[model samples]
Target: MPSRLLPPAGPARALAAAQLVNALGDGAFLVTSALYFSRVVGLPPTRIGLGLTLAWAVGALAGVPLGQLADRRGPRTVAVLLAAATGVSVGSFLFVRGFLPFVLAACCYATAQTGLAAARQALLAALVARRDRTHVLAHLQSTLNAGLAVGAAVGGIALHYGTRAAYLAVFAMDAAAFLLCALVLLRLPEVGPTAAPAAPGRGPRFTVLRDRPYALVTLLNTLLLLRMPLISLAIPLWTVTRTDAPGWLVSALLVLNTGAVMLFQVRTAAGVRDLPSAVRTVARGGALMLASCAVFALSAVDAPVWGAVAALLVAGGLQVAGEMMQSSGAWQIGFDLAPADRQGQYQGFFGMGVPLARMLGPLLLTALVVDWGTPGWLLLGALFLGAGLALGPAVRWAERANSALVSVG
Candidate 1:
């Protein structure tokens, strides 16, 4: 690992440790869970898919209110509790016998996981300095990619064995990881309520929800976030179907992404100091994504084995570079634009972009980039560019609105 990839020893290290433990479990579980549900639990793929979709929907809706709870109850405390709840949720999967039990456990799992993310962000805001928060977040993201890689390697062992016991063991390990994460989080200092409880009727339930500029920010961030599925979905599908590149290139591409992020995320984040820089970084990222899309589309052109491989490798490099920039810039923008006292709910709200991207990115990208081919890639790229271009004006609108509110107060 590069030294510049993460922050030095302190609370940030502790936070990274907790994140690593949690992600290790998640990577293992993710590799094994669909198989476990189908084979071990005797549920069909359709039921498993439906259950997960419902779970994510419930989880997405729960984020803001639970984040607000973290703000009220002390973020560290809430984070710890939610981590434990995640453990309980995963453990419940052990005895799931039918679709109903599976749905219930899945919902619990998603809700706890979502709430834990929000709570941890709130705690991070309280623990870390404003200027350092995005850098630390980059460290956390790097740690996540590293941990997931390791855990997926471990899960490969279970996948090879293909036994009920092997699947169960993965679940057990995942549960233990979240439980241990709860304990690790206890070492962090507490942060009290960010703001006093508002009197009834004094304000909206979620001020973050009502903040139109923030909502626009989240929407644009979500647009930029199409990168998430680009690697996991668009590239792989495009490779096997549209391009002559070998199937193994998929794994190679993934390795490039994870390794690059693990080494360069913090370095990329170091350049983004405030809103303007974050915006420019994201815009640059968008441009790079457009270039990557063009290269990927070109790979589909008639080419020899080595030529196709070379194009794909170059495209992968460009994509990962854009991914790092977009992630780093979004971290700062999401944190910087939010009110300090509302960091929890605001982060939770901003975090919606992730799930939104997850839910819609696949369907949209598959239709546009994979199925539609060259034009689809170009359209996706242009969408990203438009979002990047729009961000500057949107942010300016946000600043003016915020200033007016401050003047009114």
Candidate 2:
């Protein structure tokens, strides 16, 4: 059962354990952050949002540079430093009382979090064989979901108590989690960049951006990531305002989504071996997402509450299935397409898609699904379907470009 829950006892296991611990803390922090700032710190909602937005922006900008640093300095070392920084940043939030301090702390946390992600991906790329990367990622994702479920439940207790001490304890726990993650990373073997240094005046300084095919893949991958906001932000709102489902269904939907990821993420990843298979998986995920959207839209019809509840359950299941598939495919493709020597930079570039999606997804979904209603939902579905179909061609183009580069070199 332990082996079933994770990979073998090695660096993979350590990484999985680190991810689980970090995610648990993150889950608790995510649940309590808004309330902590609003109620405990007495900051206004607008200020809180602004601070977080700026923080994410800072983090996004820092990703590529920090990733390149990982290439130069070694991923394991860089990841450890970034993890420590994350802990410090989260801990600093304890002192934030006003806008500027909040922004500063949040930005620090976000930047460290983003940089840590890139470095960790590079570390994984170095530690694991290419063939096993996706499988390992799947296990990590399942572990993360399980940790988040547990963390969220624990956080709910604090939230229920609604005390400043509870909020403070949660923050301290999150900070401690980062520190513990850093300690785990410290024990991993050093995995340096795999590629030789570039020839003088030959390679582009920023190889990832210059790689148009990979860029297009990244953009399309971002489209698929719209599911994050759709599930987290849009779905809850939709359930409350647009559908006949009971309010309690919102919590149930979250549980359903998490449960599905825990159950099937690893299983779904088993088939993704090569570029073609990975691309196919992503395309299929897109179709599933489209189906999910359509089913969710159906819940808006004047149906019985049971029917709406049933539709939501179905839709949630489909959405999580799609999520698992897309994640598997993205990891496979991102790792495969990346130049081994520049894994840090390449994964950093790929990682940018998530923040980009987070920045825009909520507004886009709100405008389309919430404001525009069924028409918007259909439009959104069409957009997903089109992107899914386009991913194959995009991947092919990337492969052709890589081949051309290799031939020229």
Candidate 3:
């Protein structure tokens, strides 16, 4: 089968480098966007939050449909198109300030982001064997985090100059990065459609939801993901209102999280590559997230600057651990479970869940935090803990089902 596509570490590194560049640009934009909205455009946090929600919703809904299209045609072509579109969308923010204009730009960026993600993942699966796919995915994700760390540092410096100037700078960087990604993507080979017919009676894609273990894992991991939006929204607000911690602290938290991912993700994920052990790993990761939430929740109550700083550090570590574990387990399972021809759609479906959570989690959690304070954090902790514990049985079922599939194959 064409000597098993992803040649060796050398080629993989090249692909990964390209991905890192794109991620760096995305990181810069992400850090700056909200600040630009609030400070420069004079928009409220609520409007900024709504814009993010709508953008993520659009991204999630587009995943499977875009995956289907990529499968029918080739992922490379779609990847190039998506990357170019992302550049334009990000660049448009330089000119647009009104809510409608911003929303349109966000929609464009979201759609392109979703398309690129599905295509790149499908590209990797097409190029590599199932066993290697997990490793590659982990490496790719880790590198992306590293790039983000670098990007955010640069973005911070840029923002110090002026918010509008910072947005313009990030826009340029993002556009350039997308262009580079498109160029790299064009060099890759195509992976065609699944072996099963796209026509009906081949069973529906939604049937994948019936895989009880996979579904539970998704749910469990998602609950742990609460830390992301919580930290993203709350910590900054906390710094502003509760503590005298400087803006650099927020940047530090992000750096800590990304740096941990870059350093430990591969080593940490390597041991859990197999299906049997991945479940245990995910469960442990969930525990880490619960711990992180507890730290965050407690820190909310009359914390000193140093204490809050310590909390941020602890929280960042826990977040990286959870992200590493869940990312590894998800990649391994998705690669193993997917049919030879359906990798694109499978990965696309897996990815859709995150954006869906991002869409709903922010407003809900933020509002709760506003109304309840410490009680809100306590409730979030309980929810995450329950989700983590619940994953055990689900993982057990998935492992058994996975074994059955292997036997049949």
How many angstroms is residue 256 displaced in model 3 relative to the true structure, after the best TM-score fit?
1.9
Give the local distance difference test score of model 1.
Answer: 0.89
lDDT of 2 by residue, 72-176 (tens): 889999999999999999999999888899999999998999899999999999999999999999999999999999899889989999999999999999999
Worst 10 residues of 2 by lDDT: 190-199
Quickly count the clashes in candidate 2. 1
How far is 4's C-alpha from truth in model 2 (Å)? Answer: 2.2
Query: How far does residue 286 in candidate 2 sit from its true spot (Å)?
Result: 0.7
Clashing pairs in 1: none
- What lDDT does model 3 reach? 0.72
lDDT of 1 by residue, 7-125 (tens): 76878989999999999999899889999899888999988878888887888888898889888888999999999999999999999999999999999998898889999999999
Q: Report every candidate's CA lDDT.
A: 0.89, 0.90, 0.72
The pairs that clash in candidate 2 are 195-341
TM-scores of the models, in the order given: 0.97, 0.97, 0.85
Off by over 4 Å in 3: 1-8, 37-45, 163-166, 195-197, 200-216, 239-248, 300-308, 368-371, 396-409
Deviating ranges (above 4 Å) for candidate 2: 195-204
lDDT of 3 at 137: 69
lDDT of 3 by residue, 1-409 (tens): 3222222565466678678889889888877878887888777888877887898889987877777666667766777788888888888888776788888888888888887788777778777766777777677877787788778777887788875666788779988999888888777765555434457666665444566666666666666666667667765665555544566887677667777877777777777666666666766776676676677666656757778777767876776777688667757765665555665665666677678777877777876664466677667767766775676676677768878987998
